[model samples]
Target chain A: MDGVLKIFKFELHNLSRSKWVILYAVFYFIITYGLFQFESSQSRVVVSLMNTTLLFIPLVSVVFGTMYLYHSREFIELLLSQPIQRTTIFWGLYMGITIPLSLGFVLGVGIPSVAYGMNKLEDVKVLGGLLTMGVFLTSIFVAFAFLLSIRHDDKMKGLGFSILVWFFFGVLYDALILTGSFVFADYPLEKAMLFLNFLNPIDIARTFLLLQLDISALMGYTGAVFSKFFGGWMGMTTALGVLVMWTLVPLLVALRIFRSKDF
Target chain B: MKSVINILLFSCFVLPLHAGEITVHPGDNLAAAITLAHAGDTILIRKGVYSGVGIVINKPLSLVGTGWPIIDGEGKGEIFTVMSDRVSFEGLEIAHAGLSYIKENAAIKVRDVRYCTIRNNRFRDNFFAIYVSNSHHSVIEDNLIFATVKRNTSTSGNGIHVWKSDSIRIVRNDITGHRDGIYFEFVREALISDNRSEDNLRYGLHFMFSDHCRYVRNTFRGNSSGVAVMYSKYVEMTENVFENNWGPASYGIMLKDINDSHIRGNRFANNTIGIFAEGCSRSMIERNDFADNGWALKIMANCDDNKIFKNNFIGNSFDVSTNSTFSYNTFENNYWSNYTGYDLDRDGIGDVPYRPVRLFSWITEHQPASLFLLRSFFVTVLDLAEAMIPVLTPAKLMDARPSMRRIL
Candidate 1:
């Protein structure tokens, strides 16, 4: 336990010294406020927040996290040589990345949302969406960075692979799904689409937030079908469950990989 | 004792059972008077300017305005707080809200209200023109909202805003000179149609991660750019006209990170770029017209597997420009005015494949200064050579089945 705690503190201290987290937080805050102000309609705040979170947060998380792992390779090696177990080092790094990013999100995006959301009770839905998305993305990318780190000794290649992973999950995966739907138009793949949607962290966040916004109608048939099975509190709960899993699965996989690696 | 009992029974029968109605003239206190009204009451305001603090309604009532009553915020703070259910405020002009970068202030706001109607009102010079949050089954229609011009550093407001609300029908609203015409965040099952949005500094309409929305029959013209659909799925857009939106890196319509949507029967005409789609997939683009643009459709290589079919592409200098091969996307039965293919088989489809983009188009995108040589013979020769040999451009970038007749 002491070993794990030591690793955790060491990792967090290293993260705090980096400039990227502060830059990301400040930029996010400014951009969030700017975008919110750009919207003359108050209702757009939630949608804008969702957009910012889905697009920028994950990208930021993946890039910074992947780079962090690769840059700290020497440190990771040193930690592995110490009295601590590899699992502790991995978990420590994971927690280290997640905490600052999540904190940055809270101070950056979360604070503005709260200030704006006070009179609007529905603003809480947006707040909820942001927090969930921020945490989910932090966990996901931190684990992903670790996975990539273990695969290659080179930092650039590992970072490159992490980016490719983002592209696959963020962009290509949806395109493939779309092609499938087009090719198999008559097939009963609607349910399959729902299942496929869960494969991406962005989709889970989108579904959860959209449901909260009560704008499921925009989702067309997929949202409708999702609502039928998972709408209301139950649907939201299921989405939350999925989000939790999105975090846990990757971390678990990375942990297993880190435990037995020869490095 | 017998007389008193009879009188009590008579009083109960005689008293007005229907909800009361309050009338506010120019100098009257609208907020204080509203508190006096009962449920299902009507607050009828006659004309003239009434400036003060904001008003919050917490009852089921009809708040009617005649002669366009004005509620001036006087730069005090946030205005118009509505916390009730089934409340309606109509036919008023609201303006001059104080700036709060920390708070989302509005001229007329409906928060946590169900079945509310905000119609026939004009919101001018407010941070947020009309703010609706956590409300459902509401109608916000036929309002004229003009927002203040935003500075580059200023955190200005939107014309009509809906956040975390559901089942809203936002129709026939004229929102101009603001940042965003209509902005929806975390809103669901809403119909945003038949609205005219123009001359905004930013997008005409913007929605993020909001699902199951249908945006139809809306005209987005002469804005910085037109509408932006980002990070949401299951959207259906039909019969929307996106025109005259000319600027650097601007388009009639832009889709970023969008998935599984239908964009049909829309017209993107006379913009710098008609449609700029990036990281969007599985969306159907059918029966649309792209005419007279610098570029008709700019599909970035990052996206894949979208279907562009049965559309008319006319008079655009460049029909499409992309870096990668158009591998995942299928473009068929589209009439391209620039196409010069022969149909010897007497079939409606052309016998030879027709390339939608010219090689010079890519050169222009990378080097804007080269646009001066657009009509030069050398450029024409290169385009013709590239078209015949297919050396520079991707072979998959051609429309295999080019329709002879326009299908609109």
Candidate 2:
């Protein structure tokens, strides 16, 4: 446990200083600040911010997660040579990487939103929903990246899988869901479409944010169903619970593989 | 000849006092006061709470309240039943008319009257405040009317309900919490202006079979479904503000079978749908502001030959959505904030034709379940792909000259 804390802090500092995290934060800051500046309407700005969050957060999280692990291979092995348990090393490295990445995302988006006087009750609710969505999507994608990198021995294969996974969840899964819903358009598909969205973390996150921003547009049959579910307490807890499960299940499998790997 | 001139002068200019002013206090019977007052007489009601039921005015008289007198109906029956021409009711606080399943109990019910005026009164807790039927040249203005909403709309009544009337003017009234602010049926040549109607159970203003009616500079906010202009022709709605009316079946203006209408210079903001035009034809929707609405215009398949131009569509979720792939309406010279085309020729109009209807909006129209993918990147990409290839949406519906800037 002590070895884990030591490695965690050292890796956190190392990754933070690599300038990638700072660069990520500064990039989000500029975009968010610019959006808020140019778009006087609050909801319009939220839509732009949500688009950036949905597209960039997952892409950056997956790539950075895999790239960070591969780059710090020597450091991880040097720690493995010590009198420390493998579980400790895995947890330490996982926490160290996820914490800095999510921190970068939060700090990057939070400051701009708050600075623009987003203090109204409705604005705050929307902002909180979007920020939590970003964090969850980040963790989920990072978890997928860790699992993919852990299984692949070759760097090329690992990087390739990371990109493929990001692309599938970020862009492809929604197309599949749309096609599936269209194919079964004859059947009662409101609940079925809801179920399919639950399978894709990106859809789940987008739905959560979209419900808050585009609610006026969504006052239709499907919008009512989504708002009815997501606006309620039980649905809120369930969506978050599903997101947590998405983060944990992959990381748990990756942990098991790391514990007995021949590296 | 001199004697004839004197007679004419006496008859036309000077006569015995035909109109006398009669004052009534709290304990005085209102029906008796009306009985004593003659035609063209003034009945001045002093400031007091009077409990009266079914008080009938069968002769032409002016009922003026001096100090905002309260006329409590005690929740009994129709309060003031005016059956005479040239009768006026003014500056009175009318409250607590009875509720009935069979009868529409109202504070002031004017039937078969002409040149009637109901103005500067406050109405509260009444089934219907002012119910006018078969009346002409009547004016209802400067009245503050409110009622608590019941469980269902049938139990409540409108603020000012008019039926089978013509040449009516409803002006400068604030009405809320009723079934409808102003309900007009079979009415013609009516003018509704400078009113604030909000928080009604159904519509702020419901017009059915009413032709040649105009509403201008009115604010309809928070109504369940802001307003419905149905089965009407040649109606004009100008400079009205419709806001914050968001619901599944809600819209700023629900145009159903309305033809040859002019909806110009109105501002529709923050509504579920700005204007839902179904089975409507030959209307001109121009110079309006559509901002922050869900579907700025949901023109149905049956709508034809309408002109929509010079409107500024800003911040709307979908600028235009239709149910079918064919459109007969002309959308030209509208300023769409979502227009991304360049004006290569340096004219205010864009070089590219701006398509207001998108593929995703069309998809959601047929399959409403796809709205769950709102703002998804994949859905956006699909919309982009469809935009490049002219497919899925109505190919005929495009603004050939989209203004590069907002139409001020």
Candidate 3:
């Protein structure tokens, strides 16, 4: 545990000096500020920012995580020569990447929303949900990226696969679900649709955030089953638990793969 | 002129002699005094609480109270029932009338009476405040009606209810906390103006099967379903403000199966749906302002020949949504805030046409759960793609001449 903490602190210190992290935070702030200035309605601002987070956050996390792991191959090999456990190295790296990214999201979007008079209790809940989902997505995608880096020796192939995974989860999965619903129009596909929604992390985050917004447009949809399940505390907890699973499963797989891999 | 003055003096002296007056105190029986009074007489009640139930007035007389004498029914039955013509009731605080599912009980019930005036009265904690049935030429004005108990749909009644009555004028009244603030059924040629009706469980103002009615300058807010004008013809609704009527099935004004009406200069704000029209035709809907509503105008496909022009649609979630592809109603020269077309000729009209309906609205119409996907990037992309190729949505539903600026 002491080794893990030291490794974590060391990695965090190194990340704090990186220019890309600062640039990412600055970019997030500019876009969120732009969204707030462009639209006066808070719900519209939330929805727009959520879209940006869902698309860009995963893309950046995956690509950056893979690139960082590949570029630090020599440093990682040097660390392997030390008396450090593999789990400590893995968790330390995971926390180092996720915390900074999560902080970037919070400082970027969360601060502006609070500054613009979103301090009401309900608004805080919505902001918290958005930030939490962003962090979870960051963690999951980073872990997946680390896993890919550990499994592959070629840097280009690892980076390409990471981008492909982000595209599949972020955009293509929803398109496939929509097509499946249309093709199976004659059958009762509500259960199947909900099950498919759970398969994608982006959809889970979107549904959870949408349920928090509780706008009439979204509530008026004919899918009562989804709303009925997701509109309560029990459903919210379950969805959040699933997100936790999504974060843990990839990290655990990456840890296993890293422990057995030969330098 | 000399003979007319002499005759007016003679009639004034004789009218006082024929029209007598009776004074009833708090302890005195109001019913007994009312029975002793003749037609064209005045019964004056002092300022005190009078406990009574079902005080029936069978003669033409004026029931005047000084300093707003209270008439408490003690939850028995209707308070005052006017069964004669030329009756006037004023300056009374009537309360606690009974609730009966079998009988339509009210604080005041005027039946088969003509030329009666019910004014300057305060009614509280009653099932129905003032019910005018089978009466004509009645004036219900300047009254304050409120309900204390929160009743549901089965138990609550309207504030001012007019049924089978004609030429009734309901003006300058403040009503709240009833099922409906004002209701008219099978009544014709009525005028409803300058009334403030708010916080009702159902519609603020409801009219059904009534023709040639004019509603002007009324403010209705915070009702369950807002105002509904149905099955009426030759109606004129002007200068009314419908606001804050919000719910899943709420709207500012719902017009169903109506024809040949004029709805002009109305302000509809912050409602779930601004105007919902179904099976309405031959109506002129012009100069109305719709702002911050969920859907500005939901015109069903069955509505035809209605001209909607010069209206401002601002900040509504969906401007105009419909169920079918065929639109016979005309939408021309309306200023839509969502309109993106440019005006190169500078004629105050956009060169390109604007379509109010979106492909996402059509999809949500079928699958309501898809509303969660609203304002998503994928949906925006889908909308732009659908606009490029008009395949699924109604092709002809376009405003050919969209206004460049808002038409106030």
On lDDT, the leading prediction is 2
Docking class of 3: acceptable
Evaluate residue B334 in candidate 3 and report its C-alpha lDDT on the 0 to 100 scale. 96
lDDT by residue (tens digit), candidate 2, A1-263: 78779888998899878999889989999999999888756777888899999999999999989988888888878888888999999888888888888888888888999999987888889989988998898889888888988899788899999999989988888888788878888987888888888898988898888778777787754578888898789888989999999999999999999999988
Task: For each candidate, report its DockQ versus the true two-chain complex.
Answer: 0.01, 0.67, 0.24
Candidate 1: interface RMSD equals 18.7
Q: Give the per-residue lDDT digits (tens) of candidate 1, residues B1-408.
A: 999999998778754556667899998998887888888889998999987576777888788989988889986777788888888879888888777878888887888879999988888887888888888999999999886555432567788888999999999999888778899899889999999999887889989888899999999998886778788888899999998886654678889988888999999877767888899898899999987666788888877778999998876757888876555677888988777788888788988888887887765554333342333334555688889987667678778999977786
| Candidate 2 displacement at residue B180 in angstroms | 1.6
Model 1: runs farther than 4 Å from truth? A1-263, B1-16, B148-155
TM-score of chain A of 3: 0.96
Task: Supply the DockQ value of model 1.
Answer: 0.01
Candidate 1 lDDT, tens digit per residue, A74-105? 88888878777777777778878878888888
Q: After superposition, how far is residue A224 of candidate 3 from its true place, in Å?
A: 5.5
lDDT of 2 by residue, B27-85 (tens): 89988989888899999999999997899999999999989889999888889999999
* Model 2 error, position B331 (Å): 1.0
Highest-scoring model, DockQ = 2
TM-score preference between candidates 2 and 3, better one: 2
Could you tell which candidate, 1 or 2, scores higher by DockQ? 2
